[model samples]
Structures are given as C-alpha cells and as structure tokens.
Target: MNLGIIGQAAGLYAVTNIDDILVLALFFAQGAGHKNSTRNIALGQFLGFAAILAVAVAAAYGATFLPGSAVPYLGLLPLALGTKAAVQAWRHRGDAEEEKQAGEGGPKPLEVAAVTFANGGDNIGVYVPVFATAGIGGMSAYVIVFLALLAVWIAAGRYFATRPVIAKALSRWGHILLPLVLIGIGVLILIEGGAFGL
Candidate 1:
C-alpha cells in the first residue's frame, strides 16, 4: 500500500512539470474570450490525456511495446505541429495585421476547437508517461493529478480571458507567435530526444 501511494505521488510529480505549465498557458491564452471553445479544448485535452493514459498502460502491460529509447520519436509530433503552425503563420501573415485593425471578428467555435486540438497534441504525449507510471494501482493518484492540473488550467484560462490588455495583446500577436511557439517546443523536444543519444 505504501508503495502504491509512492507510485501515485511519483506519477503526480511527473505530470505537473514546467512543460505542463507552458502548454496550459498557451491553451488558456488561445481560449480566452471563447467559452465554448475553451470548453471544447478542456474536453478534448481531458479525452486526449485519457487516450494517452490507455496507450501508456498498454505499453507498460505489453498490449503494446516500445523500447524506452524509442520514446523520443514522439518528438516528431511536436516538430510537425510547430512546422504546421509556422506555415499557417506565414500563410496568414498579412491577415494578422489587418485583423488587428478589424478587431476580433466574432466568436469562432469550430476554429477554436481545432486550435485547441492542435495545441493539445503535445500534451497527449506528456500524459502517456504519467499513465505508464501510475498504472491501475495508482489510478487515484492519477485522478488527483488530473483534477489539480485541470483546476489550474481552467483558472489560468479564466484569468487571461478576463484581462483586457492581455486579451487584446494576445489577440494581436497570438497569430504571429503561436506557430513560433509550437516550432520552438518542437525543436526543444528534438534536442532533448537526441541530447542523451535517444
């Protein structure tokens, strides 16, 4: 039982990392002013996290297999996403400046959901490790971690969504930066994946 508790604690510790914070911040910022979209993102993230959990458990339990060394391949996901973001940014470069003057056109529910899903791609991988570590014995611990993360995630979203200046600035620069941010994260993952010779 004590070992189970320890396992749970370890899982929680792993999931609540700096990466999670940054990802949460990006998602929150993107969701600002779009309640339905934020809701969808939250739901998507939760579901995505759950799916990763299942995959992680399968890897651990032998329903699937990957050498720990192969985990780095996940880096490709972020890299691809980041590159896509960069391309999108490039494609919409002119629109970005024009949109600033035009102001937020209107609430875009579907677009918000798509953006949320894209932002969530990286997070899904993060959850995989947590689930693999937590396992059936540590389900409670995983739930606790999930709830804690969810609270902070939603609160961050709410706080930023309500801030006029922050919202305005994000509205203006978000298009320009989101792709770059994704690209940076992708590069970081690739570097980390290779740094120790993954």
Candidate 2:
C-alpha cells in the first residue's frame, strides 16, 4: 500500500465530504426510532459513493459520459425530495400521531442513495483529474482508503446525532430543519454549478 496515496485520498475525502457529516446527522435524527435506519443509511452511502467513484474512473479513462453541463441538473433530486418533505411536514403539523406514523419507516435506502449521489457533483469533478493522474496501483490504494474512511464518516455522523443535547434539539426541530437544509443545499448546488443560469 502506498502511504502517500492513502494520505492523499484521506485528505481529499475529508475535505470534500466534511459537510456530509451534518447531512447524515439530520438523516439519523429523522430516522430515530426506526428499525434498520442506520443500516440503510450506511448501505445508501456506500452505493452512492460507489457510483460517484465509478463515474470518476470512467471519466479518467476517457469514456464519454455525462456532459458537464448536465451535472448541475442533478440538484433536482434533492430539490424535489426537500419540497416533498416540506409539504409533508406542513400537512402533518401538530398531528403527533401522524408524525409518529410517518417517522416509523425512516428514509428508504434508495432515497438516501439518490441524495448522496446528487450531492456528489463536486466529488466527481475533483476525483476525475486525480484518478487520471494516478496510476492503476495508486488509484486502487486511493479507493481502499476512501471506502474505509466512509465508514468513519458515517460513525461520526451517528455519534453527533445521538448526543444528548443535539438529539434533544433534533427531536424537537429536525423535521423543519431537515427540509430547509436540504432545500438550501440544493439551491447552493444549483447556483454553484450555474444551473439554469442560477
């Protein structure tokens, strides 16, 4: 294993994905009390990141793939999801029974995966050139390190979500805050990518 490659991968993943810790915390907060929520979150995160890596690898190899201009439109996934969540939260406001029922199932794995993939526009952009420059051995090392660190990221998010003070706050306000945050992230992505001319 190349220690330098591993270090580079670790640093890059940490820098690129620091914001994901907060997002994961919010997801965990919403899924509190639901069975298999953590499992689904981890699975979704892996699947989504794998897709991003696959794309980066392919692009590195000069495979024709998604055009750069089309990347920004991926923000629609989170935008739609956030809008739906907001509508649901509004409709169920003050209905403890309905809210409890709604929270019973947690987010679907695919839903989490879609959001993860959609949020990875910058990941793809950053990864492609790095992968292109990396020889096959270095690329493999980077992949291994990145995958391992993903688990650490998930655990950190869960830890934050389960903290007494944060948990209490999220329990009270996560529903509202989650939708707003998702919407804000979506808008930021769109604007940053210059989608629809912002």
Candidate 3:
C-alpha cells in the first residue's frame, strides 16, 4: 500500500490507456438504447483488461508462451470486427427498419472484450517490463490500481459520450464512424507491431 507505488501505477495506467476513453465513448454511444449495454461494456472491458494483465504477468515471469512476433496478429481481431460492421452497415444502408433493428441489439460482451484486448497490444508491451521489475507486493499494488483506474476510465468515456454535442453526433454518425475507427486502429496496431510487414 505504498503511496509511491500507487501513484506510479496510476500514472502508468493513465499514460497507457488514455486512448481508451474515445473507444469507450464510441461503444457507449452505439449501445445507448440497449438494456444491458452498460453492464456488457463494463464486463467486457474488465475481462479484456484482465486478459492483458494476465499475459503481462506471465511474460514477466519468463513464460515464453506468447512470442513477441505474434503480438501483431492480435490486430486481426479488430480488423475483422471492423469489416463485419462495415458489411452490416452497407447491407442495411437506407433501410430504416433494418438499421433500427441492427442498432437495437448493441454490441456483445465478447465483441467488446475482443476489441479491448486487441487494442491492448501496446499495454502488454509496456506492462511486461514494469511487472518484471516489480516484486510480488508491488505487482499486486499495480494490479489493484490499474483495475480501479479502469472503472474511472469507463466513467470518463460515458461522461464524454453523454455530452449533448458528442451524443448528437454519435447518434447520427456513430455507426459509420465506428467501423472506420476500428479499422484505423487495427491498421495502426498492425503497422506498429510489424505484422505481416505491414
């Protein structure tokens, strides 16, 4: 429970995850009308982040289970998701009934989780060294702080999504923008990770 450790963990998480706010905001906007949207998003975020942390911890402990070269392949998850969304949007274009039906269901938890995990490739890279240097006690503290901050991140994203200007824009264009955003993120991840030589 060292204050320094807590601060360090918080700073690290903040630095690594600032981009998540926009992603979560898009998710919130897309899920606005669904009954279980918030719950699903939160659950998916936690599950996905947990997986990232697990891998970082395992890698820190010298588990070579997942090689660095394979990290870029994670980009395919978001790429596939974006492609699916684009196809759905194209198919439902200009059909109010079909578009409404498509929008009603919101995103699935696994879909959110997959996106979160796919987007966390850099997080894993940043965390592995930190976890390696941190002893058991320090690692525990970091994990606790990271999880708590994730809740805060989700809240911030929801807040941003609810702002009148943002909300209106998202309501109007989120479907189209979401797919492009996802695709862009996927490409960025792939290029950065050198997946398939970009």
Candidate 4:
C-alpha cells in the first residue's frame, strides 16, 4: 500500500496509454449526433482493461505454457472487427445518412471491449514484465491505479466528443476513419509483436 509506488505506476500507465485516448475518443465519437451512451463506452473500457490485466497476470504465471508467438495473433480480433466495419462502410458509401443511422445504435459494449482488449496487445507486452517484477502487492497497486486513471481517460474522451470541431469531423468521417484506425492498430500490433514473423 505504498502511495508513492501507486503514483509512479499511475504515471507509467498515463505515459504508455496516451494512444488509448485517441481510440476512446473515436469510440465516444462513433454515434456523434446520435443517442450514444457514454455509460457503454466507460463500462466497455473497464471490461477491456480488466481483461488486459487478467492476461498480464496469466502471462506472469503461465509464461512457460504460452508461446511467445501466440501473443501477437491476438491482434486478429481487432483486425477482423475493423475489416468488418470497413466493408460495411464501403457497402453503404453512397448512403451517408443511412450509414450514420446504422451506427446510431452505436457500437455495442462488447464490441468496444473487444477492440479495446485487442488493441491492448502492447499494454500486455509491457505489463507482463512489470508483473513479473512487481510481486503481488505492487501489482495490486498498479491495478488500482490503472482503474483510477481509466475514469480520467473516459472523461477526456467524452470531453473530446463535446467539442464542436472534433465532433463535427467525427460525425462526418468517423465511419470511414474508425475502421481504418482499428485495422491499422491491429496491423501495428502484429508487426510490433512480430507475429507470423512479418
């Protein structure tokens, strides 16, 4: 229960998690000008982050059982999701209003959670080593810090959703951009992890 270590862990998480702000902003922006629920986004983020923590903990304990190569393949989850969105976007390219309306139901909480978890491949990469070293108490502190910061993360994203300029652009182009971003993130994860030796 060292406050200093928790603060340090929180800072480390803040630094490493900057990109998540963009992903979350995009998620929050998904139903721009529609009835999107911030609750879903926040809850999905928590679930996703919780999943990442579980993976890191599992990796810490089961490092011998899982092959190093297997980690990167986790990228496929987001890749598949992004590709689906991209194809749907292409199919309805001419029907801009309909496309927006289709998204009005907003991304499902599970969908958001999956994307968030899949995109966290890098976080797992970093967390595994930390968990290996942190021991149980320190790990618990880090987990608490991570959960605390998630609130800030969601707040920032919701704020971004409120901005007129950002909101408008997301409203106009989010359908196209969201999928590409997700796919790019997946590819980057695979590349970074050296999955398939690519």
Candidate 5:
C-alpha cells in the first residue's frame, strides 16, 4: 500500500466532493429526532459510494468487453432523478416547513442512497479513468482510503447538523439547493460525457 497514493486519492475524492457536505447536512437535518438516522445516512452513503467504486472498477476492467459509447448514457440516471427533485422542490416552494415535517416522518435511507448514487455520475466519470491505471495494489489502497474518508464525511455532516445555526439554515434552504445541485451535476455529466452525442 502506497501511503502517498492513498493520501492522494483520498484527498482528491474529498476535495472534489464539496457538494456532498451540503447534501449530507440536509440528510442529517432531515433525520433529526430519529435514533438511527445517523446510522442510516452513513450506511446509505457507504452503499452509494461503494456502488460508484464498483461501477468504476468494472468499467476499467470491462473496457475491452463493453462498448464505450454506451457508458456516457449512464448520465441519464442522474438527469432523470434531478428533474424529479426539481419538480418536487418547485411544488413545495411555498411550504418548506411542511415539506420537511412530512419528510421527517421516516428515515429515507434508500432515497438518500439513490440520490447519492445519482449525484455521483461525475464521480463515476472521474474514478473510471483513475482506477483504470491503478494496479491491484493501488486500487486496494484507494478503496481503503475512500472508506476511511467516508467515515470522516459522515461525522462532519452530523457535527454540522448539531449546530443550531447551521441546521436551521440547512433546513430552510436545503430543499431548494439540493434539486439545483442534482440537476447541475446531471447536466454537467451529460455535457462532459457527450451522452447521445450531446
């Protein structure tokens, strides 16, 4: 395991994923008053990121077998998800608290995971190339570091949620911001990947 490579991969992932902080803060805020909410968020995030890694690694190995043209179309997953979110947000524009209270009824673990996965279209794009060149040992190191950083990310989100000011702000604006972020991510993926020839 190369310490430098691990650190580099971890840093790259962390730095490039600043939007995750806001999304996580939203999750933490939504999970308020629920005992296992944090656990659910952490687990969902892990599942989502693990899925990204799996897809990336698979793409790397399947290069010879899979048609490269088909890969970019994966952007559709996030594009559709984001459009749904935006519509939901727009419908609830006048009732933020009501929408939140409704959502607070349960821990939407799968929802979070799905959004995380969809929002990670860019991560998939970035990771595929990186993992392609990494040998088995380097891949293992990257995985280790990524999992470790995931924990820190969860902790940071939870911590931020505990702060009254931050939590309040997130609760008030997260619904609006999340949809935009998701849509932007989706569009960026489509444009960059040139899905369907743009």
Candidate 6:
C-alpha cells in the first residue's frame, strides 16, 4: 500500500499528457544557462520536495513513537486531506477556469512550485507505514522514491515541450481535470482508510 502511494506520486507526473511537460520545459529552457524562471522553479520544487520529505519522514518516525491505538488517527490524515482537496476542487471549478484564462497572461514560478507541492501532497499518507516500521531504512526508501519521481517528472517535461498537439490539449484542459482526478484519488485513499477502520 505504501509503495502504491509513493509510486502514484511518481507516476502521476509522467501520465499527464505532454502539455505539462512542455510548460515545465519552457520554464527551464527560458532559464537556460542562467538564473531564470525555470531555475527558480527547479529550486522551488527541490525545496518544496525537501519540505515534503521532512514532513513525511517525521510522520513516519513519530508514528513509531506513538501508541498503537493512535496509528489509525494518523492514518486518517491523508484521507481527510485528500477529501478536502477534492471538495475544494469541485467547489472551485470556476476558479480553475478563470486561472486558465489568466495563465495566458503570464507564467508564475511560485505557482509552479505551488502546483508541485499540491502534486506531492499524497506523500504524507505513504509515509505513515515507513515511519512505523523499524529498521526498514525509511531514508533509503525515500531516496528510491524521489529518484523515480524525478526521472518521470524530467521525461514528461521534456516530452511535452517538444510535442505540439499534446501541448495544446494540455493547455486547454489539464488544469481543470487534474484536480478532479486528484480528488477522486483522495476519495479512493479515504475509502481504503475506512476499510482499515481508520
């Protein structure tokens, strides 16, 4: 289950059509060989990822320190968060549409990082098992997962930047649908939690 969650974090970036990749690639390409927007985005994503890793690791380790009965509540954290995100996305469909229009005006680096953070939110739930397990080398597992995610992110970014048809479509509907899909995923996680009696 934990591996599934971690793999989702990595795979989601790759499965999205080439459009997201191009936008991200353009971010990096514009910043080519100098301090540019893409560099900032890369920096932001790295820092954001670091923040996520810290939180996930802490969650895992802390769970080990807590009583057995407390584990279920901790397990509920991701489900609750995912549910809330889904609800927010559903409620803010208009905002998403507006943002799509506004996105044409300019690219935002911080926004990229924000999106990256949102994309990675599921990591929290995946860490619970790692933190609770002793001598399982949680750090090693994190490294493996991070490397996998990085590869997928880079490949997708490059592919979309080079492709036109895929890019156009992604620009049109990616923002609108990505959140809905995430919400569905969150609900699925929540259901899984319920099954575990969390």
What lDDT does the true structure give each of the candidates? Answer: 0.54, 0.86, 0.89, 0.82, 0.73, 0.49
lDDT assessment of candidate 6? 0.49
- Greater TM-score among 3 and 5 belongs to 3
Please write out the lDDT profile of model 4 over residues 108-150, one tens digit for every residue: 7888888888887678878888887888898888888898899
Report the lDDT tens digits of candidate 1 across residue range 94-198.
675555323433223433334333334445455566556666767556656555665566566657645788767766676555557666665565566573563
Report the lDDT tens digits of candidate 3 across residue range 34-123. Answer: 888999999999999999999999989998667889889888998999898888778777778446546547878899899999999889
Which candidate model has the greater lDDT, 2 or 3? 3
**Candidate 3 lDDT score at position 103:** 53
In terms of TM-score, how similar is model 2 to the real structure? 0.95
Candidate 3 deviation (Cα RMSD): 1.5
From the highest TM-score down, the ranking of the candidates is 2, 3, 4, 5, 1, 6
Q: Quote the RMSD, in angstroms, for model 1.
A: 5.4
- TM-score head-to-head 1 vs 4, winner: 4
The best candidate by lDDT is 3
Please say which candidate is ahead in lDDT: 4 or 5: 4
By summed lDDT, which 10 consecutive residues of candidate 1 come out lowest?
100-109
Clashing residue pairs in candidate 5 (N, C-alpha, C atoms within 3 angstroms): none
Candidate 2 clash pair list? none
- Model 5, 12-110: lDDT tens digits are 788766778777887787677767888888888888888877888887776433365655565566567667766766776676586655744533567
- Name the 10 consecutive residues with the lowest summed lDDT in model 6: 70-79
lDDT of 3 at 130: 92
Tens-place lDDT digits, model 2, residues 129-190: 89999978888888899899999999998999999999988878888887887888788889
Q: RMSD, model 6, all Cα superposed?
A: 8.8
